[model samples]
Target: MKINKFLLGAFALSVGFASCSNEEPIKGDNGGATDGEKYVTVRINSVGDIGSRAATDNDDFEGPAEGSSEGNVTKENIRFYFFTADGMPFVMSQTGVNGTVNTNMVKPDALNVSNTNGDEKTSLEAVLVLGAPEKYVGNRPAIMFCVANATDEAAFEQFAKKRLDAIPDIEVNTPGEWSKFRMTSSTYKEGEGEGAKVIYYTDISDNVKDTKDAAMANPANIYLERLAAKMRVKGLGEYTVMEKNEDGTLATAQYKIRDENGTTITALKVNLLGWEPYMTANSCYAVKNIDKTWTNTSLFNGWNNADLHRCYWALAPGIVSPNNNTIPLYDNNKFKYGNYDGNKPTENIVYTYENTSYQPASVTDRSTKATAILVKAVVKLEGSDEGIDMVEWGSDYFTLEYFKAIVVEAYNADKDVTNQATAKDVVLKKNTGADARSNTWYATVKGDDFKRFSNISWWQNGITSYFVNVEHLGSKYGVVRNHIYDYTFNNVVGLGVPGDDPVNPQDPKPSYLAARVHVLNWHVVSNSTILQ
Candidate 1:
């Protein structure tokens, strides 16, 4: 059985404009009538568009599918922060805010922008008072950061106080830690995406006029990115057996199964049960980060959007220490599972922190890990009212009773007699050796101890599971923040690996699942890449 999966971003970008009056400036303790105080109005875009060709290759993009654009780009609120050229928090005139002198953080009310076309594009216009303006008399402030819809002011207050480089290193213990907090660079510099969203004052200094009216006319623009990545699964249609022709085209074939008597069963059915995410990260950083030394530079071809200065790679939490072995299998919020037949709109869509690993040397290597989807499915055969529970060995499938019976038959033939008990012992050894007469290996025809003797996997109720790795564009293995991974299975080659253990799944046999993939840049509508 082969499974084809596709990765798509369902959220598209739209354009909405909001503005703040320049007549009034924030004359608080931080930026009052201080001699060095300077104020600038910034036009902020909190949503990402599929048409921007930012961090994606979709230049001629249209928009997202109907009803697919949810609350992806809606900016309910806004937060503003300023930093020095050296990447430290600009000290505020007050001493006791957020436990630091950086009382410069601003929480503006939600703006009511006109969504003329109902595209869900949200924007914010805020007057950012540059403290110690005299310090940057002729020069521009280093950069500014914008956050949207961050409701937990107390939790995010800690993050807002940290320096730029330190932000990405901060650990978010759980996936639900302040869910709506978003961070994006104000300036897209060379190494900007790796750390903080640094919107450089120099990059937009040309618009930093002395007066608020002058600055508002040509204000700086910055895009905010969410700290989490989304994943969704849909049953495209009934599962089919697919094969490649000599010309590289695909051909469909019906799957065949044989009964105990070796009679081919013409009637077979496969059903889509449910799915869950496996090997996913338990935590992540507040800001996205990446490894600069990754040798596969091609993996990053479209990773960085020149227009937006956003990088797609984020080093997930626990990746640095390499203790990401434990998967939260029971966490309903993160490891979501739901029943959806093929082509249903009710499948569960979940979010995850960025998770990645170095490309393993072999298929069996487990030292490094990446996030993969655990698909649960069952196969039904004719004449069997229940799903068939079978075990696979070498290249064939058999029920536990049938498998043991075959071994017993071979043992009796070798001994030239049906010694029953004597032959059963040797056949149960899980492995056959030179000492074939040993009567120590014991196994019953039932489920209990037989599995201990045989190394074969046992599928319960014919439940076959496939662990499909989530692929990003290029050769890298990981899921990045602000992107959506949509998976659709296209083929199935064999009875999948036995057992329904989503936590620790066995490696699939060669070609058990076949895939073809395509990744396009994100823009106005939800973007999708195919994995066949």
Candidate 2:
């Protein structure tokens, strides 16, 4: 059921979703400032998180009883919001529209997530500021939600305010459940859809019980989940930065994605359609359906093989593109969603760019395995999306929903999905001549070979070109630590992987961290240039 058409209170069924947001109300967590308020430390993607690891390509967990785990979450740009019993301000309803958003309800500073570690203090959160007892309107409870960036925040509010009863619609058919998420990778720098929504509820009766019910000043904790995947490209060629030189020169080049400001991006959209992430038959609730009467726990369980195939063969639970809904799914497959029996496959949706005139491209299950993440990059200069390269990486399942592994064992050693160690479909890019993978095999004096690797570039060639899998790209030989390197330099120098590997394997000076590139310049090579 599209969240836009639904009522409120749909999130409990694990259906309604919203984008991330923030403005200013309380300041005691990450930012500087505090009003001596008791802050609720909410952790996102904690252990046993709803989105967890699976068999292959982070595929759904198995068994008769569908269960879930706390999967890892890496935020690039995130924002969240909290509303009191009082419904969200109508002004804050529709973002980037006729009215303005109530920034006061949001954090003064947005959560600028580069690599958000859900377990660490970095992911800590609290309400902006304890809302006025009057502000905490309703007698029921308050709401908490997270979205990708600013655009999503506006869209969510706009829809919520329109509902007549209980604004910010928390009812079963509320707009929250109807909220559309960007399930696929981002095609442009601005990002694709409003992204996904992760929301929860916290009782605030103590804060808004009676007119005199005050003194309940505290920041609440809120956990968020990404309904949509995140993917972007780096603007430099395929070179991993191994280390920085004494004179400030790059010893080796590696693939580390950066933003317009040249900041090292630790994570990208791994997978929006994550493993066992509330899918088919369980994706949501059908308030109007007379057949299967479902509940919250029973629905948002996980994905099963039967449902997986059904999702793949379906048209979609929602629209493919948020902006442009034309060019419907050609698969002509249909399934059930809510009360409808001909519901389209939600996973089959596409992630295209407005720059491409909303022309849908191959970011689908039929075309490639790495359907989850799209590496968006500005290859020309800095601060410009002129030459954006939207490249795909990951396996075919769940579109292999976003891969966020650094130095991960990404080889399909068994060659197929058999013993599924690392994404079973992920093949080792066969490097030739100097950069061959077999060279990384090291035989110690003990007659034992320990395969070591550096932050090397692993390319994934698609309709776009050869894009690097930064997560698995490591060095074959290295004690060289993590160092920042400039991509535009003529000498793409890495620490140990010298300018010339023919004579001696170039290794850089020692350091605590391994190689890393602060900035990136990507080159999406044509099919002819593919190494493998």
Candidate 3:
């Protein structure tokens, strides 16, 4: 068996380029072409540590050689590699006209080249050119220089800038005396130039430490660090940074969104991906992870604005009437029956009805005639089939017959009952149609009936003409739910209780006696005169 030797130490410039003839080239079975391609070569001659004291001493610190220490003090050389829009690689080579090779040579196609100046060194220049001119166009190839030293870091940066500016079509814009330069090409727009962006790594003393701290402290810095860490882990070379900016506050930063591919996105529409409560009071809150590695099986789940609202609501205390004035008596146990006095009413009212078991014989007699008459008139105008039960008069339980009797009695009491009666005309027409439930009932009742209901002193005094008609069927029959009622008659004349429930059984044909209670005094009108 024969062994093939691999050429490992050959320099990129050593690749031999064979002269081409006008004859057809031969092709190999393994797809190797007989023709050869030419490539550009760049060279850099670094003068070695010019700004260091070691350069002045002839002592060889590392070796016994007479000039070893002097050589060690020479400037350091750097090279960069670039590819055309098409896939082609080139190495930059460095060559000095007056001195020996002290620094590392530049790569073949590197556009930006830099070297430090020694104390003894008066003038230093590097020669670089593309190896293959046929492969490129006008001003397609260029070079940049960055000079730096352990001391006076800004000097080398300035020198580099001056050198870069000397090159044709290269312009530097230093806006605020900032040490950075914005290099623009005369041939192209702001960011479209060949060497559009160039950064000088002048200070390396604490570069690593500073970058590490930034990565840990700043989100944007962390993002860069993560990218760098990924590059290292994946062994991916030639990674470039496009842009970075500070986040809203130093605490939390937002990066101009990116796509999966490592391309710098220029134009994008950023709609807040997560909930922002500070932006809107009604806004909900949510949690988001940056890694994007979360799966359905992960312990972390996505939340929305609704979830935030739930959290706030949970922490918030129950709505306590600002002054016991805004809340209805129905909610206040002390005022279980009805107490609008300033002093805190006694809790004794809470168990009064429970122990008595004695229901008010007539919810509305001559004594409470004004209140009863007003309620009946309102119910008639409301066209509420589920009549007011004893509950409306402050009873807890309802018998089917009793509920029906209350409705019959209220209907009979209406002296001027008319066939054209409808709650819409009487109650709803007067108020704004902003609330759906209220507007619906108002639109349904007759105008005449609404007027009559709105005119009754007691009903007008206690109940608002504008009331919402809610359906109480099934499980919802006995459950009191809130409704939006507006009163236009007087500022004080508002619906006492905003919640309502069906007095009769919703199903089973009323197997047991039931009564609908239109609980009164639940919500009071703000500016009503009668209630005040």
Candidate 4:
């Protein structure tokens, strides 16, 4: 980001001044003086682009090999929404020579925003220059920034400038509302994810008092949380990651998954996954393993963002603990919920890219907790029949690929044991839909609908990958039970009966896809019986 010494000097002179000599300046400010001497030179240190995070979507806490997107963020159409700490939107009143605004807004020099720097080592760019906000003039001030990618930059820009209230309702293609104007909190708790130490506004400005430090404790650092969960391909054999201190800790497995067509799938894109707006204060936060991870993160005392998350991620929705689905106010070791082993939750719960942060969006009741990732698939495997070739769930097939989702991680969290069910060439029957005491998509086959068997949840708590040979999955497994659930919505079943205009969330009756997979007989099932 080229900072024109000339422009910076002129900008500093014009803002807050009653008059200016900006006869040749970009803005109307020819040149002027200001009353207050507070100006924040915010550099865009975008944390967590897809490439940097791809490697860490694993058992390892620090991100992947420094430059693998793992297919998270995109290299093109990068955008960052700049705003006040209080959520007030800011427009681009100025852009230097290299600055240009697509439908989406851009900072003068965005480091990793577009991956222009070539790798995770972000370029020396991406910043927002601001006049001292009047609200925080006397009080300590801070800024908020969010990163997102959009196909249509103009559409994103129009959306980004609106008040948070109106942002969700507007419909724009490519960048869905959830992925679009739906702004996520960039203010991550320190030490949970990877990034530089956040800079306080006081530290950047002329303020001598560290009022913000006293009020918020941690400095204001903005991290772009990964919106998409990662799904990597691997064989049936479990590949455990040893501690770095342990011999061969650096060793890791490389998983490659292919579609029915045999095309190598480097990474799979995900959508319609569960996302809840910032949990309202005092709402319940249960079993988001990161919370448990936090005890060790900050020693269970304060918010430590980077240290808390094993893999900085968006929480996948579902109840993994089969024993208890109840969400508590919080779990800081007291009144804390335990895992299936009846042992209290701990930070060392073993990390996986697929998270178990199933905090209820509205802890008030069951009616409003409907945010889920919808999924439906149709594919013809090498020699599989029609039943095995196509699989469809959710309200409609007409929904775009953006809505089709995959369940990455689902486990029985309540107890140490999971249900053991077997599918004999299962083309699982869609037993019922939307209405029933329990709508189970039973893996029972009537005709040739069944193909080879596969488990929904991998034993190692990662994504379920394909293996051409059942022998590859192993020889000591039994039933692979894929737990299918149905929903009861507000007078609508299956995503609002198809024709609803702008068929999206925020509709009168929305549908969600939050799943939990419980497998039985890990200690008993033979690989021959399980894979066959």
Best by lDDT: 1
- Candidate lDDT scores, in order, read 0.46, 0.23, 0.18, 0.24
- Give the TM-score (vs. native) of candidate 1: 0.67
Pairwise TM-score winner, candidates 2 and 4: 4
Please provide TM-scores, in order, for all candidate models, with all chains considered together.
0.67, 0.28, 0.15, 0.32
What stretches of model 2 exceed 4 Å from their correct place?
1-31, 36-40, 46-105, 110-121, 124-127, 134-141, 152-221, 227-301, 304-532
lDDT tens digits, residue span 112-230, model 1: 33332254333322233334434322333445665544445564576576675665566664435433434444223354335534332223445445555555455565555655566
Better of 3 and 4 by lDDT: 4
Query: Relative to the unseen true structure, what is the Cα RMSD of model 4?
Result: 20.3
lDDT, candidate 1, at 341: 30
Local distance difference test, candidate 1: 0.46
Error of 3 at 416 (Å): 4.2
